[model samples]
Target chain A: MIHLYQNNGYNIVLDVNSGSVHVVDKAAYDVIGALEEQNEFHTPDTLKSPETAAYLKERLGQEYAEEDLTDILEAAAELAGQGRLFTRDVYGDFIDEVKQRKTVVKALCLHIAHDCNLACKYCFAEEGEYHGRRALMSYEVGKKALDFLIANSGKRRNLEVDFFGGEPLMNWQVVKDLVAYGREQEKLHGKHFRFTLTTNGVLLNDEVQEFVNKEMDNVVLSLDGRKEVNDRMRPFRSGKGSYELIVPKFQKLAESRNQQKYYIRGTFTRNNLDFSNDVLHFAELGFKQISIEPVVGEDTDPYAIRREDLPRIFEEYDKLAKIMVDREKSGRGFTFFHFMIDLEGGPCVAKRLSGCGSGTEYLAVTPWGDLYPCHQFVGQEEFLMGNVEEGLTRPDIGDAFRGCSVYSKEGCKKCFARFYCSGGCMANSYKFHHSINDTYEVSCEMERKRVECAIMIKAALADA
Target chain B: MKHIKTLNTQTLNNTVKKGGCGECQTSCQSACKTSCTVGNQTCENRK
Candidate 1:
């Protein structure tokens, strides 16, 4: 399949199967569009015909002469022969092979504490206990979760387990025990375990930072931005701002792990339309990795991103891109999560087709050991796959999640951002539309703008 | 190695066009509801 769009005044064409992106002229773009439209109406075998050429000339004749139209069609046909355009049925073999293989859980999100100290309004987990009950994952459940990941990993050498919660530090002792347990299991099973911790930084003291720096593979520190913005959105249960308390601790942690994998993750709401300033604030505080994600909630909330905020959000992205370029020019470049696209070494077609490996390769275990697709779906019983003891009792749910891909989504099949986005977040789809394959249109717009901005940055850097 | 052609000055100067939701004239809420519901039936079959 192929996708076409306009970005920064340039006509861009993406060949999904070939993983090639071309910047074509208007004439070529029109010809490719006509060919794709015809293929949609008819069959692939009947793509080339004198009548096809006539139809193309009739549609695009005012822009191009008959000879130029013929040449453009011939070039498009050549691309088709090379398996760039009109590439249908390319995923059948891969699908068959995947079906015959065992579905293993490679990564697990362990909810260390169902309770949190902070009262972030946009907390997806209903302030950490998932709005159902307040609890903490015992050492017994945590150890069993590690064992489950190792047993079901199926020849995978490196497995990932993230210490997640309303605040993982709330159950600090159990987290320490699980790390030690994971190390013991790794030695016994000859597998490697990589642990990550996501914290709100309220309980990040010297000891916690030391343990995180020494043992954890990565740490996700949650701090929104400027003191007022963060405090307004992520206030403590006592009704005080957490920015001052956490910023110094986060700065120290970031400084201690000079070259380690850590991100200062922030969430932007309707209140902070100019979130580029927040990103710059993190950069100024000496953070090397930053991820600023939009808040996910229903539109009824006052802080949810509304349709009117899109224009300002797009402008903020452009401003962020400019800041990134300036930082690179000054030799102090920091990595923004959204702009880090590996165009040269993109994911293989199978990986792109399957989207994020939520159910099949990844799962989240709640405090009581109930399993869900990911952290977002922890409380939803319909998403429950199984517990550590039962080991994936709902294989049908797993199969359904594994079957969801861009190939299954009708609108995504023709999007220029299909390979990059892979049909968006399944949790969002399930929450908004109650379907795994459906995509949020707001996310689609945001992602397309980001892709366009990234491409423009690459172009500028190339010319520089 | 595959070749990727970057956007140049001439190509960047061409007239820009909008497709999909970018060109829709309806309100954002109405347009999004319509666009996101395009393939609901097909999605249900897969589920």
Candidate 2:
């Protein structure tokens, strides 16, 4: 299957199955479009067939000379011969095999603290309580969680543990102890633990900075953007802005890490439709690694990204891409999270993108040791997959999550971004709709545009 | 960014293991609803 689109003056053709990308001129692009429209593009042999040749001539003859059209057809066919375009999906036979494989838990998002110090208005975890009593993961629970990850992690040598929470810093001591224990186990068990931390910067200080810089593999610092934009949604319980308090600390941590393995994560909402400005502001602040995500909220909520907001949001993405082109040419390039698509060597090359690996392999552990598919599903009891003590008792729910993929989801079957996006976040699918096979339409739209912009940026940079 | 010739390139087919999120290994995916960063595997500090 092939998906064709023109964005930012680049006519990009992507073969969905074989993961080939072609940048074609107008003639070639038009020819592909014509073939796509006629639905005759399957085999290269068919493209050279008499009927297909007549159709191509009838469609593109006026625009191009007959000889040039034939040449374009041959070129497209050559690419097809190389398994680039019109590649058939050979993954159908193995889809069940891949899903039915043993649950190898390689990563776990440990909810170290199910509580937060700030009261961000759009906090999806509802200020880190996750709709449960505020608590912290004791060292014992964290150890059991790590032990479970190792036990279930079949043949995997490297394991990941993300210290996540209302704010992981709220339970700093346990986090430190857990890391120490994980380090001790690494040598005895012959497994390596790569730990990461995500925090709101409320409890970050010189000591915390020093330790994370020394031990943590990666740290995600949360901040929205400019003072007003960030302060509006992410504020303290006292109704004061945390931006002023956190920016300096974040800046310090980023610089200390040399901006290599850390991301300054921000959130955009309807209030900031001009979200590109927030991205630019992050660059202006000297942050090389940055990510600004769209806020997920109820439609009734004031900040929810609604359907009507798509056009402006799409424009914002285009604007950001254009700016990125210029910035890169001037040697001022910075990393934008959504724009960091690997067109060549990423997971798309792997032929199967299982999304966030929520239920089957990557699970979320609450402070009390209860397991959910992922952090987003922590409060939803229906998704509870069991705890660290006894391992996954709800294999049925695990099977349901394992069954989810672009091939199974009706909305994702024809999506160009299917392999790249894997199948979007399953928690989102379950939350916006009752079924995990569904999709959050607004999120899907935004993700599609981002994929386009990301590819555009790649083309622009290669030229530079 | 059209090329003189119809520039076509085949991407590298890296046989990646499945345990890691079939997508790139973006740690930010914890609450990620909209933006899915594709390649998070080759981090500077990841083991």
* TM-score list, all predictions: 0.82, 0.94
Docking class of 1: incorrect
> What DockQ do the predictions score, one after another?
0.05, 0.29
Residue pairs in collision within model 2: none
Interface RMSDs of the predictions, in order, are 14.7, 4.5
**Which residues of candidate 1, in runs, are more than 4 Å off?**
A6-11, A24-89, B1-47
Q: Work out candidate 1's RMSD over C-alphas.
A: 9.0
TM-score of chain B of each: 0.14, 0.21
CA lDDT, every prediction? Answer: 0.73, 0.79
TM-score of chain A of 1: 0.88
Per-residue lDDT over A298-327 for candidate 2, one digit per residue giving the tens place of the 0 to 100 score: 889998989999999999999999998899
Worst 10 residues of 2 chain A by lDDT: A343-352
Clashes of each: 0, 0
lDDT of 1 by residue, A1-464 (tens): 56677655556776655545566777787777777776743333355677888788788888888877877676666655655556554554555454445667778889999999999998888899795899999999998999999999877776888888879999999999999999999999988887888899999999998999888887888988988899999999999999999999999999899945788889889989889999999988888888787887798999998777899999999889877887888898898767765555334444455556678777889998999887778889898999998889999988988888776777676676766666777888887889987887787788777776776566556546
